[model samples]
Target: MSTAVHTMNATALKGRARDLGRRVTVLMLLPSTLWFLLLLVTPLLIILVFSFGERSAVGGYAGGLTLANYLNLGSRAAAFSNTLLLAPMGTLVCLLAAYPLAYFLAVKVQRSRSLLLTLVIVPFWTSFLIRTYAWIFILSGKGLPAMLASLGLENVRLINTPSAVLIGIVYGYLPLMVFPIYVSLEKLDKRLLEASQDLGASAFEGFRRITLPLSAPGVITGVMLVFILLMGEFLIPAILGGGKVFFVGNALVDLFLQSRNWPFGSAVAMALVAIMLVVIGLYLKLVARHGGRPGEGAL
Candidate 1:
């Protein structure tokens, strides 16, 4: 009877401890939960509400239920098309450029890996706006164009073009793409490659069969990261495209700040959010179909 009572008491104490732990966890999460609610969820809810409203005569939301704002999305079709086209294109370009660098960092460089990695991210130490502004100068008529002109390529217009925007996107987002793929490749089991080699597979064949499949998660992550940001990209296009190229983000800025079309802006934002969700869902489904996990990379 005494032993049974002791065991019961210990069980009760364990239950109380678990309860206390849960309470502590809840307490610890409370601030972040509140912050998420106040900052993210609240704004999203407000945007959703405002998306259904009307634009006031002067400006801003007029607080009425209407689908006119959504219906008017067709007007910005060009911006949407530009964003859709350039975002993917930029992501692909970044991927093509980043993969070899990532592979080199992960596989080839052994001693100065840290230094090289530092070099890769050194640009990030400066302000992003400043970096982008520098690109404006670099691509200007007096910059790369001038150099190219001196090299016999006369009248080369690099600035204020889609190519300039793409260059900016690749330059700005390359590190983001590289790091994920690098981490994936870095953590990969090298033994698999060696085994494939022993089994008479060529380097390319080994990469195709083993390395590529394993590194797929990182590729997906990098692609998603670059693509999503590119979709909402404004500053690069604004600075480099010189009012020639327009994206959904640029349109949003114009609506909110320039035109003060709050309702329409909200509608556009909501639509962007919906589109992102659909794209992400489709991407995840595609990855899953191909036996790839999107969240497999270390970083």
Candidate 2:
């Protein structure tokens, strides 16, 4: 009888300890969970709710649900078109420029890798707005235009153009693209490359068969990061584009700050989020399809 009682007490103590551990785990996660809820989830919910509401006469959100805000997306068609075209193109240009730099740093440079990598990332130390503003002068009539004009080129205009905006996009996002691909390449198994070479594979063939396949994860990550940010880009366009070439980010800024159309801005914000979600979903599906079994192409 005493033994049975002792066993029951021991079991109860163990169960209580398990419950205490579970409580501690929840407590540890509570701060971040609450932070995400308050800052991210709550704002998103508010935006979604506001999207369905109407704009007040005084230029704020008004009560009552309606699809009028979404229905009015056509009003900003040019913004959408500009963003959709340039963001992807910008991302592509960044990728093309970054990949080779990343490869040279990761696979070629041994002694100066750290120095070269630092040089690549040094631009980020400056304020993004400052860097963008600098470009305005660099591309202005007293800058590249002036230099070109001296070479018998008259009336050269680079600032306030789509080309200048592309240059800004490429410069600003190149670091983000380079680091990911560099990390991917750095982690890649050199044994695979050596074996391919041993089997008489040329450098190009080896890269195509091994290097490119293994580096795909980095490429995808860089693309997603750059593309998503570019979708919401305004500063570069504002400075370099001089408000001539507008993007969705510029549109959102004008709607919220200039026009003070809260409901319309919310609707545009929701659409941007939805489009990004759809794109990321499609990307995941494509990754899954070409994932080609475990331990295959993955770095």
Candidate 3:
């Protein structure tokens, strides 16, 4: 009787497992399916439709296909130039800044790692807009400049400068930049380091051969994330640059809100999307090229 009961239980478990797996598959897909349809797919279709159309006299998308809107794309060359130049630079700066923090948090300081990580993430608790406002004051003439002047530096113009914009970008995105690298570093096999050192590799050499290679995925992810958002960043340039540094984001804002040229704006928006795609593709290619090791899997 006991043997029969055990066998029946095994059969029941198998049946339940199959049912659970089906339910799990549906559960995993539900959120993403909804997100794609509502957020991504819908907006993309709207942008696509707008890209092929013309603008109305009163300013908005008009129902007619035209190539003129796309032809006028060259007018915003400076915006494109600024975005292309700054986006990568900002991402690089964030990486350089974040890597050290993440490294220290992951490798060096073993105590209170949770506390330290919380510190890194705490800034993200606030809205980015609110944080940018705080930067406004900090970069203002009365903020850092005032402090500097007391120390015999007569004049400093941090506010409304490219440097200010860079600072804002780094500050705002540092948390984003840190977390990925930290996860990669924290998940790294400690035994690999031990093995490298055990085999007579020096500290720096061990890091170079082991730690750096393993963390490439995080590096790639952070770079991709920060670079993409920086491309469409208008608020940073608008506030920190004070209208001097024109980005494609700013152009889009003006074309839509100020100029009321919806079709042309849509074209520019589409062009911006294309540029972002190309940049991201190039970034991924670079990552794939350098990120892969002969024996290791690509993350």
Per-candidate Cα lDDT values, in order, are 0.91, 0.90, 0.87
Worst 10 residues of 3 by lDDT: 290-299
lDDT of 2 by residue, 16-130 (tens): 9999999999999999999999999999999999999987898888778899999999999988888888888999999999999999999988999889999998999999999
Q: What is the C-alpha RMSD of each candidate to the true structure, in Å?
A: 3.1, 3.2, 4.8
Please rank every candidate by lDDT, starting with the best: 1, 2, 3
TM-score (C-alpha) between model 2 and the true structure = 0.89
Error of 3 at 29 (Å): 3.5
Query: Best candidate, TM-score-wise?
Result: 1
TM-score-best of 2 and 3: 2
Q: Model 1, 41-149: lDDT tens per residue?
A: 9999999999999888999888999999999999999888888889989999999999999999999999999999999999999998899999988999889999999
lDDT of 3 at 52: 84
The lDDT of model 2 is 0.90
For model 2, the run of ten residues with the poorest summed lDDT: 290-299
Note the residue pairs that clash in candidate 1: none
**Residue 220, candidate 3: how far off, in angstroms?**
1.4
Query: In terms of lDDT, which candidate is stronger, 1 or 3?
Result: 1
Candidate 3's displacement at residue 247, Å, is 1.9
Poorest 10 consecutive residues of model 1 by lDDT? 290-299
